[model samples]
Target: MSDNTKAYLHIYCAKNIIVDEQKFSELEHIKGDDLEDVIKVSTDKHIVTANYDLPSNSVFNSRIKAKDISISCPLLEAGKHYVISIYEVTPEVAATEESTFMDYVHAEEIEKGYSICLYRKK
Candidate 1:
């Protein structure tokens, strides 16, 4: 992977995440005792294919019409938000057929029934 190559980090487990500063600022005004706290997970180190669109009832989705939602994955929970990050991975990592995150996850799954990944982007 060249320095120009980039990778996308998708946190599948997070129920709520603020990807941008603008959106994160809004959390302060939300009134509720059960406000979700943002947990900064460390990056163990982390596709643009089809132009698929999300269903009309997709979560954290803008009411727009376009074919850019092709990368949608099944949300583990409804009405929850997950963070999507994009960054460059090391050349060694990017060269792998599997993502660095997946590589770590798969190894953990074999060693332990459950695994925890805390990856913070640099």
Candidate 2:
């Protein structure tokens, strides 16, 4: 069995590119008009399992500790751009690109594992 740990996964949708701290801080308090800027889609606890042998073609395969980190979030939808933050405190806006969702994968044997995928918006 793969070793797994409980972690908080914060999902954010970027409306526009965050260049400065002021614009980045807006992600914290989402207002009416600001809603179009950045939206905190989902925040939840999940079991993150390490995949030692990840597919070579996978985009996240090169990322440290990202290759096999699997979690289930039904709220995720296909074809939508998202930023997946895996940290206790507020995640820095800079990790947005590196932490982007790859895409969804079906895991039938892994308990509680759902379609896992991550992708960036063009």
Candidate 3:
């Protein structure tokens, strides 16, 4: 009944900041409690920041379509733990945020040369 691919959904768990991306798929069915907090949108802007647990705070840029986000920063180096967040920021959220490098390969656009979803590891 929808043409869009659901990428992100879970505001309650994300609110207390307990939801972990590594277990993102587990949150898919998370519901019945404070789930209404989830941000519903035709479009939204978000950022993916990766922390390699190093003194240097270097991050790579990536984007997500709609209000849903799914990305794992692959900057893991030896002897380091990586942490990333998909922050739903305000005051700076712009229409251009949806226009990103990853948008081209969004799940819905897969047949149109955005076939990168297969390597996304779900």
Candidate 4:
């Protein structure tokens, strides 16, 4: 991939990931110890992080997974769809009539159960 090409790294099997500031700031939790930590956003890396204090109803989701709740829909390409394994993320849920979060995600197929994914934007 060219240096100019943007990469979405989302690994979930590592520690102290070396991601950019936006990625680190996009962490699902850090709101409260009583909140549920779930995968919610896409980043340059696949190494997702979350605590076990998230709500039981909210799960990090994407359109590719359930189509019910997923912000990653914009990440999907037109004809170059690759199978990546998406881990289950249960984050804090919104109270309004419309939830402000994507709390469910499923990978069509993952890299040996790994959480790293790379797809060109279409």
| Candidate 4 residue-wise lDDT, 34-65, digit = tens | 23222234323333322212123325642222
What TM-score, over all chains together, does every model reach? 0.20, 0.19, 0.19, 0.20
- Which pairs clash in the backbone of model 2? 51-68, 101-118, 101-119, 102-118, 102-119, 103-117, 103-118, 104-116, 104-117, 105-116
Candidate 1, residue 77: Cα displacement in angstroms equals 28
Candidate 1 TM-score, true structure as reference = 0.20
lDDT of 3 by residue, 1-122 (tens): 12143333323223222233333243333343444222211223333212211122225534322233333222222222112223333213322245322221122221222211211111
- Give each model's whole-structure lDDT: 0.28, 0.32, 0.27, 0.28
Candidate 4 accuracy as lDDT: 0.28
lDDT of 4 at 116: 23
lDDT of model 1, residue 32: 24
Q: Listing every candidate in turn, what is its Cα RMSD in Å to the true structure after a full C-alpha superposition?
A: 16.0, 17.0, 16.5, 13.9
Candidate 2 regions with alpha-carbon error over 4 angstroms: 1-68, 90-122
Model 3: residues >4 Å from true position, as ranges?
1-67, 87-122
Looking at model 3, which ten-residue stretch has the lowest summed lDDT?
113-122
Worst 10 residues of 4 by lDDT: 89-98
